[model samples]
Target: MKKTSLGIFTVASLAIACQSGNQAGYDASGLDSTALASITEEAYKSYVMKLSSDEFLGRKPFTKGDTLTVNYIQEQFKQLGLSPGNGDSYFQEVPLVEIDTKPVSPTLTFTGANGSLTVKHLDDFVVSSKRLQNDIKINQSELVFVGFGIVAPEFNWNDYANIDVKGKTVVAMVSDPGRYDKSLFKADTMTYYGRWDYKYEEAARQGAAGILLIHETGAASYGWNVVRTGWAGPQLAMVSDDKGASKTEFEGWISQETATKLLNLAGLPKDIQEQAKKTGFKPVPMPVTTTFALKNEFRESKTNNVIAKIEGSKRPDEVIIYTAHWDHLGIGEPVNGDSIYNGAIDNASGVAALFELAKAFKAAKVKPERTIVFIALTSEEEGLLGSEYYTQHPIYPLKKTVANLNIDAFSPLGATKDVSVVGFGQTEIEDYVIKSAAKFNRTVKGERNPTTGGFYRSDHFNFVKNGVPGLFMGSGSDFMEQDSTVINKRKAALGGRYHTVRDEVTEDWSFDGILADIKLFFDIGYTMSMEKSFPNFKPASEFKELGDKRLAK
Candidate 1:
């Protein structure tokens, strides 16, 4: 059972504050206003329960669940009087290819001066390929331990210095060297370089045949099971123009235990990772060679992005997008005899919020000057594929799009005194968030765990990459309850259920927090839509240049 916080402010106060907030640009006495006011706890609860129900079959893309999920969202949009976000249809077809890879017997074998060692799949290591090939084989590729596998000229760090890894396999650590040496990167905060995506990208750029990241739970901020499950299922990717030719043949992870044993076999120091964290560290050539054969069964399918729009009264072409991924792990390995991975809090809540927000807008007496687009994206759990595709083939030009506000897994642990803004300080949108949140007697805080790279993990990152400001906010732990212990325990419990089958809707969930967050987001987006100018990335942000270039175009 979940614990409820008995706070200084009662639930009645929270409801009154949220409903009585200044509806500045909004029509004060319209159906929309009434709808917004009627976003009651019971209504929100019903939406979540139905969306996350087992009948949806976990809402995985390319399955019956996808059909039901998209149909339901479309029906809701129609009921809300929202027109198709696309030209004439509520659906945007995203072409995708699913690769179901099963490693051959004796999948990974390492041979070194210490003799041969075999690692079991999903036990000692988890491997997957981005390349679109039926059969992939690495024949005794030389293994070289290349620190963090980072090549950042700005940081003056090159792990591949004085080494040629072309046609060879590179074994690298999960995060950047700065994870250990605070002064190296962004101190303890993770940069894009620390992301596994960057490691694989850097390896592919250097012509490496394969890349293996050594997993450390603390450094990666997730357990090995996450890695195993995420990569084990039918991996989906946007059907690349080059068919993933630019990607490395293999990208995988090895458990810390497996890594230590591999290091011993290679006659390398077990403390090599420690040594690599220092300044001016060079690549280490391990005496190990690896061989692996992977077979992939491929299927091509198309998924639909449920997009609904509220066109602006004036600048109809100008758009503000609200995004959330509708896809989850699907029916996967059962946990506790339950095979369905009902992504209740993982996203059903966000989609439910999407519906509620749309209703609120539709019922408004007056619409904003800019278009508001609500997009229920697909294949986010697969790698933000839906949003990525939208950016590539945007319904509206990126230059005309003001900003993106994304809602993913919201906290159900009751109302809080603050809201955590991921990627805080990167854009001016945060200022709007602060102003809107303050009306509720709440504050805005930067991400509490920056090391997890939470900012880039969600659908908003795709927008940020394309030079549009995006905001991904979550519930803050600073609850109304004086004691922090209650909130901390709640957070810990949520973390355990994340990405697991146990992430189902529970009766104990308090919609007060979710309702507050949704209202804040609605306010921010409404404010942006009413404004005359677009929100730009801060000058210090790496994405600022891209935004400027896109806007100029």
Candidate 2:
């Protein structure tokens, strides 16, 4: 009943077409081109609209929304006849601890030679404890400005080189030194050292009691609202043996205005922050101490990762994975009279594409030679938790996983002439992407903004960390009906709506772009699934050694 370029062909008609020396028709393996073309815009839009509806409550983890989302995806998988990806189960339990902390009245107090200064919460600063404890406090913790708080030997940079930050609170800059000097580290592109996650990890390693990063828009690539939303409600993290005690007692951010006022109070020039950008800049011990305490409320909970598989007909043990996070910011601080962060484009779109891809593979007359596993992950907004857990406790052997193809936050601007491959040159999977896109007269291009550190920001990074080659692609800007200016405007508009209530499904949404992108993924996965060769990380990749090690094992 479906129309395609190759025309509507049933099984019998496809067989007849194949008999006429038509290589594009049904193959001996029973794969019909018509079925591949059956992936339609209507099917894709239906899934997105349903998943991003208000009834789902934004799909945040450990909420009613989470329950509704997991159940829906599981039912879809069951209906599609996909076997449980986990051992006899479609769900993989991820143990998590949720911490809800509220600052005591008079949240932050700083005392030094200039006198005492009091800062309010939410407006000037926000703080919380990751440690699982009834009471947490930093009493007169000596405050020190530790530049970017980076200590990368590769770049010959260390902000805490001569100073001992033990038992002190380090007020650090948001990004790395390279942000100022392009020659420092990876030029303008942000390395692992530039991420807030890396900042917290480094601070913990230095035995700091607390760390507050000065929020800056350009460097952080987001506004304060994102930070506030992340700090609000119940914060989820994988339960650790130490209950996160090894990390700082409290980690947070202060507005640039607040940081300036605090610096002035510490008898340091407001403009002294620029000094920290230089390589030889030493940690400046602010002539002040900060005091704060948090009364904590904690709950231990679990979330499920929905995984389904279509086993290979030939190499059953080998796998090609497709992943997308289903979780988004749930009911939080309201914006424009809307509390739900629908995340329609942020992730609901990606999940819908996952379902469509699964449907396509299932509908194919011939099964892939290597297994295909589709995973709808949870808590990606929190920090790639589901994928990290799965990697640690893998359902299939890591060495046998030929490649990971991740879809996240797709564009709705219709089909384009190119696709953006995040971390394009890091692995050999780019070859497959290029080949697949070329089939439709589309080209493969690298991410337009590598400085955002986008390669490390998504779920695929987890797979790459475990030595499996992973590819994450998004729709490009060269729309068929629109020029670069219109495409750029659409992308800019989407950027403004990211992580906000305005991210809900809109009337003008188009699925032509998504349909093309999904078909590209199908082609890439199919090629990987049937090939005898395994893709490896390129020589320049930091993950190359890990991939080689895993393969060797």
Candidate 3:
């Protein structure tokens, strides 16, 4: 009788939880395949083909392609009956400073007590800047070669130690020095210090006149052209830093070959970059003077974040957000006779999934207790700008926001028996996913490339940074535990094609995988919306404090 009474009380408690809000739980009867089936491979293929067509002009941040891109998404949101997300408005303006550095000739003249050595561009080095200033010249400033430009206090690692590089040029490693020396930092995986934004911010913090990251193909991931195409445009960032641009300035990345030649002149050992890996590695001031002239132009423009809401029948203010970034490399150099960067798998798949989820929610007649937001963010390709701005300037208080479920680059490669979470173990979000995937006889899995740092590579990082635990998931590589070799090849191949023009629409995709993944994401949103308490990040997650702070409120 005691157990029965407690069980009854718990049931009654759940009933009360439902009464407290209008967010609807999933029908025990479950979802239908009809809508999932409607989200066809052919449809996705067509959308990607159109967007990636040469017409869109490699969807750089502020190109005309952005105009067409945002409008299309806004129209879709309007049709979905989603309410404006950003304060009675769908658009959040992100003001950016675009810096283009076209050095007449980038010359690095490194001098020792003995002699000097000069490095050439492309063959020896490459450089670009983020400071919106025109033509910064460093004629007499000393060049300090810091390993990775990191100052991680948590690790007791300080690349800047006691020597200040203010007004000097920093020739640093592009990625994390920790990556190079695993004994000291998160080896292979990118720490916050590995990010380019971190480098620029650190430089500005030190008052450096310029910062240059030495990029290696292995370290920076993409080639120089990827950096060039994205940087050589009107970039959009928040107007200030507390609100925006406050902490960052004068940033650029140079090739490794360039750094090697300079190191030779500085009398530094070429093979033992490992020396800088240890503690007490002081900043080396090679007698190198670098000079470059940068001239750039910009036309600031407005783009809208596509926002639509399905009001919860009971909890109208609390929300479950479905986010997808809608921009890509617009148009660039032709590859294999094609110049358009149709971001088919890069994100059109993710956006298409966003709509698919919205449609599924609307069709579910069982309305949620919490409002559901469908957001197609802009300028994600330009460095998660739209989502970052949204997190900073939220339409709804994040305290009331249940979760951020992000969709990006849903590869349509045939059906996989499992789903992959980018940050595999960070949250119990995977629990919701596994419970939901069970309906379709699917399984959940961790990303194959945890070493590659896939989790930190998406827009969800913005939400993660803000304390709202976010999830980035995609199709699993294990096709029913299919040959691991095939999985490895396919994963590598798909990763390669992501930012390339080759990623356009194809008849090669099987919608079963896309549908399965979307269903999984939808199930996640539904579960979060129906719960009484917001889902908190796991103990290991860095965002735990954010949730605790909100709960304290």
| Candidate number with greatest TM-score | 1
The lDDT, on a scale of 0 to 1, for candidate 3 is 0.69
TM-score: the better of candidates 1 and 2: 1
Model 2 spans > 4 angstroms off:
1-32, 269-271, 483-495
**TM-score ranking from best candidate downward:** 1, 2, 3
lDDT of 2 by residue, 1-553 (tens): 1123113223333443345324545544333566577787887888898999999999999899999999999998998789999989999999888888888774578898979878778877887778999898778899999988999987898988888888999999887777788878877667778888889889999999999999988888888887777775678888999988898999889988888888999988666889888778888999899877888898899998999999999999999999999999999888778899999998999999888888888877667899999999999998899999999999999989999899999888768888899876799898777655655567677888777788889999999999999998988867786567766666666657778898877765767888889888887897678778999999978789998998898
TM-score of each: 0.93, 0.92, 0.86
Per-candidate Cα lDDT values, in order, are 0.84, 0.84, 0.69
Ranking by lDDT: 1, 2, 3
What are the per-model numbers of colliding residue pairs? Answer: 2, 2, 27
Candidate 3 matches the true fold with a TM-score of 0.86
> Mind giving the per-residue lDDT tens digits that candidate 3 earns over 1-553?
5335334544543453344334343333254444444455565555666656666665556778777777766677677666676657766666554444555555655566667767665445555555555555556667788876788888788888888787788877766665666676665656667777777788878878777777677677777766655554445555553432343334566666666766777777775356776677878877666555555443445565677788898898898888988888776767788777878777777877776677777776466789998888877876788888888888878888788899988766667877788776576676677656655566666777554466676788887787777889888866753567755665555656757787866544556677778777876787677678777777866667876787567
Output the worst ten-in-a-row residue range by lDDT, candidate 3: 20-29
RMSD (CA, Å), each prediction:
5.2, 6.0, 5.6
In model 1, what are the clashing residue pairs, if there are any? 32-363, 32-364
